[model samples]
Target: MKNEIKGCIKALGKLIFSLDDVLNEAVEFPKEHFQPCANLKTNLKLFAAALQKIDGKYMARKDECRRLMAQEEVALAKCLCHFRAGNFSMDLLQKAVTLAAVYGTRRQAKEMKREAQKIAFQYDLRSQNKNLVTDSKAKWEIMEQLMADIAHNINPADYQPEEQIAWEQILDSFEEKLREKNLDLKGMDYNSEIEELFTSAREAVVPLKLAEKLKEVAVERTKKQKTLLETLERGRE
Candidate 1:
């Protein structure tokens, strides 16, 4: 029983460590990039507390540990949805607000909605400017769609391979435009951080199977994104 408890503690410790890494990255992001809910830190704290509750009798505290771990995972995923290279759309922010309502205060949820509306208004004004390049407009619209799809947890497997391939071409074209402008998708770096998060989660004992599925999704997303960037250099020439 003592050994089992030690194993559980070790696994939870790894998960907590990964969550800390991604949350720290989120904190360093610019305000315009994404707004992480303040409650994420609180969620992390509660999970950590559960870890501390472990003793020689693992069964006694097992349920509580499982519950906290599940809650933390949901909160972390919700926070991650808000992260994008540029400003998020009102739709995406509203979705985030809904997801956050499960763990955040009513006041915080209302504030998020207000922020979303303000940003949406600003985007509308920006779209009306005659000086903005056509490419910039197209890129913004496509990225917004992509981010929204991710926020909605759209399964890549749900689409046919041909459809997926076509989307990849679209992304390649988008990345090429960014290359011409000497800009890169900054959110690609966040995907790497998310990949690391799943790597840690996969090590935990309680939700090992679920973690594997999540990691597979994260890994595939990162892989597709990196592939596009890799081809951009040669394709541009």
Candidate 2:
């Protein structure tokens, strides 16, 4: 799993470098119609650096995998936002969306695919920017092939980490432990084994030092869900 994740990220980094190279060539190609954004190369460079820095070893543990995936998704999001904020071409937009869909969870991939479809719709509606549209079309086949190769090398489950642990899951685990220890919570059995079980349950659910971190995760997850819903609503409208 670690090797697979590392390979996927390496492939993505290469793709970003190729993209940056293309942008650089476009700058020197003596084209009047399609000038790349000033910060486009910088953004791509930063994003590539971020991807290269991801610790693929984190896949060894579930909690580490969760955090690693979150960090990766955030980097992708920041790159996409940078592109959206500038006057980048349609191809750049599609590329960002493709990367996001590939690296994100199932829900994230679904949302990104919707965004890509919307881009296609808008491309069909607009009469101007034919050169830009043509350029995007020419690159689409190659991009698809590259993405396919990358996707084939990765495990889908690695991208789809369990984002949150439900309260019921921990409660069920606690209950099972209680049953094994033959200790009733409401009974007058205050033995050391019962005390240890309670301690373990508390540690599993909420360690003292990690409580604030867990709260932050909850808040961040909520914010992401809210943003995704709003994006979906806007797409519907």
Instruction: Return the TM-score for each candidate structure.
Output: 0.28, 0.25
RMSD of each: 18.3, 21.5
For model 2, how does the per-residue alpha-carbon lDDT over 1-237 read when each residue is reduced to its tens digit?
455445444444443456443233111111211223333224333433333333342344343233434344444534453433232345555665665554544454466567656755666523354423422221232222222222222322255323332333344565578688785554234456655664576468655566566557547756865664454345434
Summarize candidate 1's per-residue lDDT along 1-237 as a digit string, tens digits: 445445545545554445443333221222332333333223223322322322112323343233333333333343333333233544455555664443333554466667656766766623544322222333344443443223223232122122121223334454445566576444233344333432343233225564456557657755864554444333434
Q: Count the backbone clashes (under 3 Å) in each candidate.
A: 0, 0
Query: Which segments of candidate 1 are over 4 A away from where they belong?
Result: 1-85, 125-237
Give candidate 1's whole-model lDDT.
Answer: 0.39
- CA lDDT, candidate 2, residue 158: 50
Clash count, predicted structure 2: 0
For model 2, what is the C-alpha lDDT against the true structure? 0.43
